[model samples]
Target: MASSDSTASVPDLPSKPPAWANGSPSVRRPAFQWAPYLFLLPTVGLLFLFSLYPMLYGVWMSLRTTDVIHGTSTFVGLNNYLQLFHDPQFGLSVLNTAWYTLTVVPLIVAGSIAIAVFLRDSRPARLLARVGFYVPFVLSPVVVATSWKWLLNEDLGVINGFLKWAGLATIPWLSSDFSARVSVVVATAWNLVGFYMLMVLAGLSQISAEFYEAARIEGATGWHRFWHITLPMLRPTILLVVILATIHATQAFETILLLTDGGPGGATRLVVQNMYQSAFGRLQPGYGVAQAVVLLPVILFVAWLQMRLFKQEGVI
Candidate 1:
């Protein structure tokens, strides 16, 4: 009995770890704890130098009144921000930016999805269409703006030439305030639609073929299938596009700069353009920095709202 009790109390010998396991004696991992960080050092350093430093410096600049020519600055606290509130040009710029965003974002989103859906075919025509639409987006912003500027020029423009050929009066495409805004919108949309379409296409590609097949099997119509299956799955991607479009529209400067140069009036003067004028053109860097700092919050708020909406829809 005693011998049997002693045998029962004996612990089982520890089993050997598999050769693939980290604890296995046969495998030895190099103890270079700092290697991963070292590999990441370049990227982290670049981010700090370019992104973080600029942002911090901008914030610092916004709080001071700096004479760029004299290389002198004096801290004025929130006076610049107060001046922004009272500045009519700044107010107009804010309004213009808001209008631009409201008009362009919906058009881009809808047009992109439609183009993506239409181009999903396996035919050569569809392949060509995809390439044609996507090509404009790859062009440099300056090139795009320059081409469009010549095309929309009042007297010398091809558009006006065509109007004359068709016996229609030459429309002031960029001379009138309303028409200038409209022209900018059209030009901006034409430039960006291709990129938005590609984004939608990527989302479309992720959706399983079986879903569409099953929907068709149930005798679902094309519209029904799109509304029920495609749109639902593409929601996340659409939100992403909207967020990006908002940012682009809000900060739109180059296209407007090249196309209208803030127009016959101040119709196309966006906030960024105003900021640019204050910073470099007017030599009021501190005022420009304040305008930029103001924009940061607006952009963050919009982005946060979009992300919140995306999260609600189960999108990361």
Candidate 2:
């Protein structure tokens, strides 16, 4: 009886084998917690090399007088920044970027929301319309600019040709300060509206359909339903659209570069274009870097303010 009790008290030897027993293939060892961190090592290394290094180097370069010709750089403290402030072109570019943002952001947000609402139905025709609107957003910025350039040509373009045929005077879409600004704003809006529409549409999809059904049964008119349900539910998406559109507008370069070339009189010269011209066109890398560094703070402040707004509204 003592011998039998001793054999039975051996904890059954785990039926087969322990996890750490030799050659125990069926036993799964505990996962190593560091495995995920090891997998992320390459991504972290690349981001440090490419992103963080460039940003830090750019800041350093901004403080120095870089002579690319002689391959020498000298520390210039804040002179580059001070000179940029005194430059009239810099001021004009800031104003143009502000104006562009103010003009395009509102239109893009409102128009996209309206279009998305009108196209929200899953009917075949509405789906097709959504696709048609989104096609422009996927096109390369160069292609979009080139196409608009031809279409908005003062004399030979299809739009002007049609206007002429209808006995309307051909408008110079790229000439004069007002017309140039308008053209850039309209072209930019057309390119970006689809992205905003898709964002808002995604938000609309998240909302339960039962809300609308209940509202209808309770005698809510279309306008009342839209105001009470749609608008409030869409606040987060609208805020996102506004922030992204503002940033893109501030960096408006490719469209204006191809469409206006900062001319008729530098009317549409945005901040990014100004930076390009300063860095490459004028060979003032240090000054250009300084300008970009200035923009960084402003962009950060705006982003922070938006975050504050999001927090206040519990959108975050």
Candidate 3:
């Protein structure tokens, strides 16, 4: 009777075996298992369509001799690239681009850093100043370029007018090679400084107030604190800004077009302008695409060089 009672206390098992008994899986999925992928599909599709496809197509086009009028292309392998190596105009454009980049990038970085440091305090005046600096960045490139052109006109521009009023000789501003280069650099830097200042301000904000407090307790002056503490902490942000500025300077087009139009004997024509003329103006699409393709590696090399330098300095 005891044994039967013990047996009766045990629970009965179902007659059917478990789902896994016959080597079939029994894991159940949630109803929303694919919801994340479903949401991501649209973004992925758009990227593939717009970004990836164009890039792949451009590379393909770079290898061919494209006749835009006839809508035909012939495989020319690396001939277009070879042709570019011997092209003097292309070489000149590359040199001009380098000079513009080297000049404007430093100016942008320095000016932005100075302005950002000045405006770090939360005073109302500083806030107003910040807004004033950033206003030009938000304006359309066309509008900014047009305004600058008026200001820097050779004879009747506002700046020359002021020079005359001050009993000083007026500058050529845009008519001469040297002055045209200076005008473009000044205009580009002025237009971009505010945007970069905002970036630096963000970097400044990320630094802890405790740092300044600690430095003050150590009898550090303002310059010492900036040099030792602030600059060291801001390295990563500075690196990012430099790389971006380099790329922007290299690819500058529309502003140069509107301001100088590669004037004073193509003094301001950049690589992109050369590429534009090759593809559309000269009807050599393949050659133009080749220039663009080569530019990608140049940009990548610059960015990589920056990364390496920063790494050596322990910035990253």
Best by lDDT: 1
By summed lDDT, the worst window of 10 consecutive residues in model 3 runs over 1-10
How far is 19's C-alpha from truth in model 3 (Å)?
A: 28
Name the better of 2 and 3 by TM-score.
Answer: 2
* Residue-level lDDT tens digits of model 2 in 36-67: 57889999989999977877888898999988
Clashes of 2: 0
The residue pairs in collision within model 3 are: none
Clashing pairs in 2: none
C-alpha lDDT of all candidate models, in order:
0.84, 0.83, 0.83
Q: lDDT per residue, candidate 3, 3-112, as tens digits?
A: 42111121344545443323224535424356557889999999999977988898998999987888989999999999989999899888898899889999999988
What TM-score goes with each of the models? 0.83, 0.82, 0.81
1 against 2, candidate with superior TM-score: 1
Clashes of each: 0, 0, 0
How big is the positional error of residue 15 in model 1, measured in Å on the Cα after superposition? 33
**What ranking of all candidate models by TM-score puts the best one first?**
1, 2, 3
lDDT of 1 by residue, 1-316 (tens): 3242111122333445333334445658734366567889999999999988999999999999988778999999999999999999999988988898889999899999998898775455455655788788778778888998899888899999999999999989999999999999988988888888877876787788999999999999999999999999999889889889888776558878988998667899998999999999999998998999988988889889787875675544
